[model samples]
Target chain A: MQTEEEFKDFILNGHLHYIPNVSIDCAIFGYHEQTLKLMLIRHRNMSSWSLPGGHIKRSETLVEAASRNVRMHTGLDNLFLQQFKTFGDPNRIQFNKFDKEKWFEITGLTSWEGNWLMDHTISVGFYAVTDFSETVLQTDISIAECAWFDIGSLPPLEFDHSEMVKEALHTMRLHLYHYPIGLNMLPEKFTLSEIHALYETLLGKKLDVSNFPKKLIALGLLNKLTEKRSIGAHRSPHLYSFDREKYTLALKEGLVLS
Target chain B: MQTEEEFKDFILNGHLHYIPNVSIDCAIFGYHEQTLKLMLIRHRNMSSWSLPGGHIKRSETLVEAASRNVRMHTGLDNLFLQQFKTFGDPNRIQFNKFDKEKWFEITGLTSWEGNWLMDHTISVGFYAVTDFSETVLQTDISIAECAWFDIGSLPPLEFDHSEMVKEALHTMRLHLYHYPIGLNMLPEKFTLSEIHALYETLLGKKLDVSNFPKKLIALGLLNKLTEKRSIGAHRSPHLYSFDREKYTLALKEGLVLS
Candidate 1:
């Protein structure tokens, strides 16, 4: 190991040093009011919005950083997060034609001179679908506003973020067919329509309501209840809840839903 | 656009290092005559062996880096490399701490201190299942020796790569029930016994040969020619080639083999 003094000297004089560019961005997804919602943070100064994200520290592992970033952004405790993919394109950021001096001057909160604004960035994209009802997000000024965006109508995003969103949504769709996901999006008990609406939001289309509920219930991921839909004008749909015990057991047993 | 001057100054002052510590190590697999092969390399001047890997460049993506490194080490081209996971345990190098310094020294590489080196290091893991019969691998001194190790009998590996092997194998096993992936390890087309043997090597047990041929022919991933097995006192197993047309179409249409 280089001595601390050597490290400081090395930092001060090294020519064209390399830094691993790693940031943790979460695709915090949830189902709300019959729509699949994704958590987004609007910028304070820049005319852009983003998935909650930040850099990983020297001591933090990738997963740790992701969980921490998500919790800090969403105020959700003990939330489990998994890294889905890492985007590393030499040209991924050509859009950031930020003249360094000017961009730094413009975003005055940062000191570019001392910050070794490394360019070789590899972003690890993580995903977690949780329930909207339990999330108590602590909003930050760095994040001027926070809200959930319906998956069907995502606004244009800055950077390659739009592509990242597309990729995450694609992965979620695949997972839905093969795995018992989106459990965190619903309540302790929900109707078939709620689940179908959630699926529609994610898929950006409607589903055959007649076939979906039977297929899902047959998957054994959901537990049926004696309760009927508590509030509805049409014929009440049956109430159901995720069978966490069986689902968790099946997942641990390596059941690939597909 | 970050100016060349700003990029240079960022490198010189340690305020913006560009080299990435994240590397990609591939656990390439191939199936041969009743055997499974794992591609491995011996580091120059080191008795220990490692998976084919290299530094992720600023302009480079993980897929590019892993494929390039594998090609460089083995003179192999167009191998199917898949990005599966990233390994970043804070202290994964407790026993092999000196290996990193020694490898860099031998390679005559410079550091991108501070933001690059001191900040963090994250490595992504990729996997490739190739048809060894088609790849023409070139070996060099950068890697003193290269060989395909049998999965059942692998020597100890350097760093945390052994764990990476386990994960890759798990992924491969997960694919077996769905599609015939080990075909990538075989020649253009050979006999039914050859295919069965390859599975035995992976499964680590003997299998009944009588029913194997019928099952493979039913998968429609193979085409049987009038050729017969030439070895032993038995009829030659029919030579077959991978149905590339079906494989490509299946993958494109997301028609999972299972």
Candidate 2:
């Protein structure tokens, strides 16, 4: 939404075009140079940060809605996305905390009872991983600011978002064992040490450096290239790249890596 | 619902007490004697089978609604339940196939365009594992029949349920590698071969017999008992049971087994 009229109409009659009582929230993880970060946004008239979210359109699928939300905020597309969980606690959104006065100024309404936007909603959570250095953050009329924060140091978020981030990280780490990652975060041809560092940073732990690369090679997801990058005297390490066919197959039919 | 009046009220005014446009479907897997089965139900006016499902109450969480649906059909509780996926496709439900004449008899309405139950609904898919031998199947006014079908010989299902089953089984098998299973499917005290059979049946594949038990032992999820089961005078094998503390810990914080 861009204009005041659109915002007012959405708050009042969005259910005509979008599904009511159902929304989609995304936990977009950014990785670059062995540093991990998360994307968060602050809505207009809100004091705290929150995950970028919106309701599903009446004509779109769940994943399409999520992808659209992510694309709108990050200016990136085709990221590796996966659904982590669906959260539906009745008390998840405390309505008493809603800023009714500010909303009244925008919506021109004193009471929101029986409104489509005031009902209890269930949100589907999706997680995506992309290279932070490649994204250009964007904001809309409803969002006051959009930025990335270090994973270790994050401000207190609004609603059940803190729990959503925790669950998203846990599920993403578990998925590392089953699915293939690092497609967008790494160069087309990289060294073993580079990929190892990527994995360690995403997992938030140290892996046995010797055993990590070997597992990926054994799974046929990686292929050794004859080329090598020269850094110093007697310090050239062999280069490797993902086998696109095998990597795509492993993604569809999961394979154990650890 | 048990009576005609209650069913009529649910179709006409259920949105007053239940959340509309959100439902829950369960893929209940039953394991007994090296055989795996799935629970399927047929509605009163439908010919095709479907995973047993219902809507969520205003006061209940998502999981609670799923548990209640499972309990109503299986006559059991506290099974190992998990949220596999939430399905929301625009064309997932074929309303043209709906038996409008039969519904008209109960609802006394020729058109259900604005009815709460006739809207596009998104269903949350949950998978559960339990011992089928312990459950006594029951049906309500809406369900005409409920029974267990061997997993390998399931007939065609309705409303994208076959896809739901495929996804559910894929997730359950993937979960087998991370979480502790076989808690309710196996006897309190079982032989290594017994658990081995159970895994094979559920995975629908053969595993190397030698390496399976050792992985469980190394994880500290199993304890060997001194007593042995005497199948023959010359062939007596040791019995083992789950380490409750370690198993519970593993369930909370997942561990790799394969």
lDDT of 2 by residue, B16-74 (tens): 88888888899999999999999999999888999999999989999999999999999
How well does candidate 2 score on lDDT at residue B200?
A: 89
- The docking quality of candidate 1, as DockQ, is 0.33
| DockQ per candidate | 0.33, 0.71
lDDT tens readout by residue for model 1, A1-258: 124444443334332332235666789887667657788887554567777776665576777878887787777755535556778877665434444444443344354454444445667888887876678775654456778878767777766788788777765655554456656677788887777777777666676773455666777778889989747478777889888887676544434443
Question: What is candidate 2's lDDT per residue for A105-212, written digit by digit as tens?
Answer: 998988988899888789999999999999999999899999999999989999999999998998898888888888989999999999999989999999888456
Where does candidate 1 stray beyond 4 Å?
A: A1-20, A95-114, A136-138, A177-179, A190-246, A249-253, B1-18, B45-47, B99-119, B133-141, B173-183, B186-246, B249-253
What is the TM-score (0 to 1) of candidate 2?
0.97
TM-score of each: 0.73, 0.97
Question: Whole-model lDDT, candidate 1?
Answer: 0.64
**Residue B183, model 1, lDDT:** 46
